[model samples]
Target: MAFSNPFQTYQKQAVSTSRPEELTYMLYQGLVKYIRIAKNSLENKNFEESNTFILRSQDILSELMITLKTGYPVTDSLLSMYDYMKARLIQANINKDQQILEEVETYAVELSETWYNAMKEMKIKN
Candidate 1:
């Protein structure tokens, strides 16, 4: 019998049960996490590992972009921000620049904070 990793199983369950807003919050969390690890790897002069992490974070940003609903003014602004972030990530990966990763991390933090607070407000109002 193949033993499944408990953490992986738990993560799949958590995702399956989460609401849309919760999933968005989770994506932001993952993005920030990947960016931080990439930054650390870059700082340590581990270029290959940094590239892998940055690409993983970029994929999350792409997912966020793909799922954005149309007809809302906020969506346009968010699209722009996501595009900028992805571009910055590409540049950071190519250059192996820790500073660029830090800048991207700041944006990720802002996005996650704003998203989380908005969700909390929505919950209270509902």
Candidate 2:
């Protein structure tokens, strides 16, 4: 018999039960986290770890971009922002630039906060 980590199990259940808005919030949080880790790794001179984290952040951005629904006015703007962030991540990864990572982190943080607020407003309405 194999044992699973309790935290991992809890996380899986949480994600499985979350609404789409919650999932988007989670992704934004993840993007910020990966960017922060990449920045720290770069600061520590860990090129490989930094590269890996930056790539993870870019993947999250790609996921966000692909999941956007069509016919919404905001969708196009959000897609553009995601594309810009991914480009910055690529530049950060290539140059190992902490400043570029910080810029992306700023955007990720803002998006995460905005999403959280929107969720709150939605819950209030419902």
Candidate 3:
């Protein structure tokens, strides 16, 4: 059996490194952090806190994408998926929808895992 560092293995890899580290790094970090918080809170039946984390995560993603002139490889379907998930997150927050929140939390974890895995393989870091 082998043990590996998941954090190092699953970080997001940006296509270009010309930008400042803060611009490239913190958004991704925030995404990763809030997703975990949301997931954990939902699993614990803490709906309020989970919703908060989801909103925070959405804000981070919105902020990061706002200033990007060069787009990365998050394709149209994925972009639509993000928008849909983000909307569901907001709806969950407004309606106190636990089931939807759990679903979104699961989605976030999977997406983050995929993003991190690719980043790890590409050897990109802050």
Candidate 4:
């Protein structure tokens, strides 16, 4: 018999049960985490691990772009930001540059915080 990790199971449940706004916040959080890991790994001279994490962060950006609604005026700006971040991640991965990773991490953190605040305000209004 195989054993499943409780934390992994819990994370799966959390994601499965989360509302769309919550999922967006989670994605932003994930992007920040992966970028941070990639930066740390790069600083430690772990190129392979850094590359893997960078790719993961890029995937999150792609997912965000795909799921974004087009009717909103802000959609274009958000898409542009996601594209820029993904490009920065590619540059960081290719050059093994921690500075570039830091730049993306800053954007990710800001976006995550903004999303969290919006969710909070939504809850209060409803």
Top-scoring candidate (TM-score):
1
Q: Worst ten-residue run, lDDT, model 2?
A: 70-79
Compute each candidate's TM-score over C-alphas. Answer: 0.98, 0.97, 0.56, 0.97
Q: How much lDDT does each candidate structure score?
A: 0.96, 0.95, 0.68, 0.94
Q: Write the per-residue lDDT of candidate 1 for residues 33-78, one digit (tens) a residue.
A: 9999999999999889999999999999999999999678999999
- lDDT string, candidate 3, 1-126, tens digits: 989777665544442443454444556666667867876787788887887898898886676555555445555556666677778778877776667767766776676666667666667653
Q: Deviation in angstroms for 61 in model 4?
A: 0.4
lDDT of 2 by residue, 31-90 (tens): 999999999999999999999999999999999998999678899899989999999999
Give residue 102's error in model 4 in angstroms. Answer: 0.9
**Which order, best to worst by lDDT?**
1, 2, 4, 3
**RMSD for each model, in Å, please?**
0.7, 0.8, 9.2, 0.8
lDDT of 4 by residue, 40-116 (tens): 99999999999999999999999999999977879989999999999989998888888899999999999999999
Output the better candidate (3/4) by lDDT.
4
Worst 10 residues of 3 by lDDT: 12-21
- Model 1 accuracy (lDDT, Cα): 0.96
Candidate 3, residue 40: lDDT: 77
